[model samples]
Structures are given as C-alpha cells and as structure tokens.
Target: PGAVLDLSKVIQSFPGVLPKPSFGYAIAMRGGAPNENRYFIDGISIPTVSHFSIQGASGGAVSLVNLDHIQGMDLITGAFPTEVDDALSGVLLLEGRNGRKDRWGLRATQGGTDYGITFEGPIGENTTAVVS
Candidate 1:
C-alpha cells in the first residue's frame, strides 16, 4: 500500500512531473502550474482530484479517488490531445475497474488516518455494482 492511499501519489513517480511546492497533493508538470493541468475519470472531467481542495486551485491534503477501484491511469504531458482541451500543463486519465460479476465480495481497509469498506457484487445478469 502507498504511504497515502490517494491515486495521485502514483504520478509522482513519473518523469517530468513534480509535486508542487508547499501544496499538498498538487502536481506541476514540466514547470506548468497545478491548475493548468486537467484530470479525467473514464472520459469525464472532474474539478479536483484531491480532497479539501482550495477554491480556484487544485490540490489538497489527500485524494478523493480510492486506489482500490482504479484499473489504470494515463498521464499526458506536452503535445495536447484534441480530446483534452484547455490544459496547458498535463492531463491525467483514471480508469475504474468493473465490479465482480461471478460473486459478491467485501473488502475493508484501515489506514493510520482513515478507514473504509467496499462492497461489490452482481446486480443482475449483466450488471454489477460497487459501493465504497
């Protein structure tokens, strides 16, 4: 498990990306400001990726996305893509995993500062649900 369960922490390992100075959970890509970057989840744009985010800025003490549910992530810096607009720095795309279909499952997590329970199960023949 990561020091912090926030998914954003994963990006810090990537080259050319650095955590913004004096701002928790905020990232600066290729010297661009934090707000210049954009974040997307499954093709949908979200205002902020971190919890307790500041108004008119992005970054906080933690991330709102649960790492357990993430399937994959793509970080794009420089060379803007047509699908992602209005970004001057970078773009992060987060993909969530589908709930289990064969059977129901439950998972509980306890961290130094937080705890959570996740429930996933089949809703119907072809539908599944995941609640955290």
Candidate 2:
C-alpha cells in the first residue's frame, strides 16, 4: 500500500514505488525489459501497462484509485504457480472486495481529483460483484 511492488528487489526486499508522473509502469523482472511484463485487473488482461499514456505506464494515472474499495493486491514474479501464464517477466493482480452474502455494505471516498464508491450484496442468493 505504501509503495508499488517491483520484481528486481524480490530477493532483497519488497519496496514501495514512489508515485510520480515519470515513473514507469513496473520494474523489470529479473532484468527483463518493461514491455515483457503483463498485468491484470479483476482477471482481465491489461493490454496497456498504464491508462494515462500510450506508453501505458501506471504511476500517475493509477494513483486515482480510492483505497477504501480495494480488497487486496498480489504481485507474482519468478516462480508463478500454473493458474497464471504468459508474461515471462511478472504479474500484478488487484483484487476487489465483493458481496457480503448477507446484509449490505457500502464504501466511498473522495480525493483532490478522484472519487469512488463500492457496494456489495447478494444478487440472488450466492452471486456477487464489486462495482467501482
């Protein structure tokens, strides 16, 4: 949460990547080029590394996420276990919270230029989705 994850430091430590306009999308995994990596959002393949520019970097444009709605984050590199393939470099997965399966839940947040809301509840009995 404090900093973005990078693969180069996997053996050294997990460090937070500073949020800046010039920062690249992700670190080169095991010294691989940036373009060789791949990322996903809610299981959807992200064609572009970032949404802000054609270069598709993720530093500035992605800072707009409302942390209140985030469920969890997972960044896997080196030895990925089967379920994930492609991207010889690395993988970043951002998981959002879903229905509570009982009552109802709501989350909202506001930043200088960003705003977001999240609602979770049973659709028919056991189906759920977290809308942003």
Candidate 3:
C-alpha cells in the first residue's frame, strides 16, 4: 500500500472517467467519497464495514460480500431513483445467488474480529436452501 497509484494507470481501466487523488478510501469508484455511495446485499442494505471504520460511517460501508455467491453488482453514479435518498454520491447494488440446484457445499473463513461460513444444498428435487 506504500506505493502511490498512478492516475493514468487507473483511468486506463475505465473509459470516460478520471481519478482524483483527494478521495483516498481503499475502495472508491471515480472521485467520490465513500459516504456518497450505497451498498445493498440480496436486496437488503448492509449498514457497516466491520465494527467502526470512521470514513465508512460518513459515507457508506464497504461490503463484505463473497464473490463465490455473488450474482450481480450495480454501481450508479448519476441520476438515481426516488426510492433511494440521503446519498449525495452514488449507489452500489449487490445481488447474490441463492445456491446450487441440488448439491451440498461448505465454505469458511476467519479473522481476529470475525468468522463466517456458508452452506448450501438441496431441500427437495426442485428446491434448495443456503445458510450463511
């Protein structure tokens, strides 16, 4: 994290956008502050990033979404719907997959502050249940 990120290199990854150095959150889209964004998981809002990361509280939480079960991500910058309010910047909409049709699987991970697990399998011939 020591090395400074080149603005030119970042811009190359996205078309028609520019990177401004002032917004230094570990994960920010464009030049917007973290507070200017929103995050949703499975149609529900996730309110915090770990217990209390200050910057996130001012903006919005960094999602703890697992890519393994993720089905979709939508980040909107300009002109949003009326259903969303209070955000001066953007919205990050995340959608996750239900689970496999008829198979069982388990995944786990741990850190000093948190630990998590996910289990998924079949409930019936055409039904499935996922626990996380």
TM-score of 3: 0.60
Report the C-alpha lDDT of model 2 over 5-47, residue by residue, as the tens digit. 2222221243322223255434455555555566666787765
lDDT of each: 0.80, 0.53, 0.52
What TM-score would each prediction reach against the true structure? 0.88, 0.61, 0.60
> Backbone collision count in every prediction?
0, 3, 1
What CA RMSD would candidate 1 show?
1.8
lDDT of 1 by residue, 63-87 (tens): 6777677789989998878988799
**Prediction RMSDs, each to the true structure:** 1.8, 5.2, 6.6
Q: Work out how many backbone clashes candidate 2 has.
A: 3
Ranking according to lDDT, highest score first: 1, 2, 3
- Clash list (residue pairs), candidate 3: 35-59
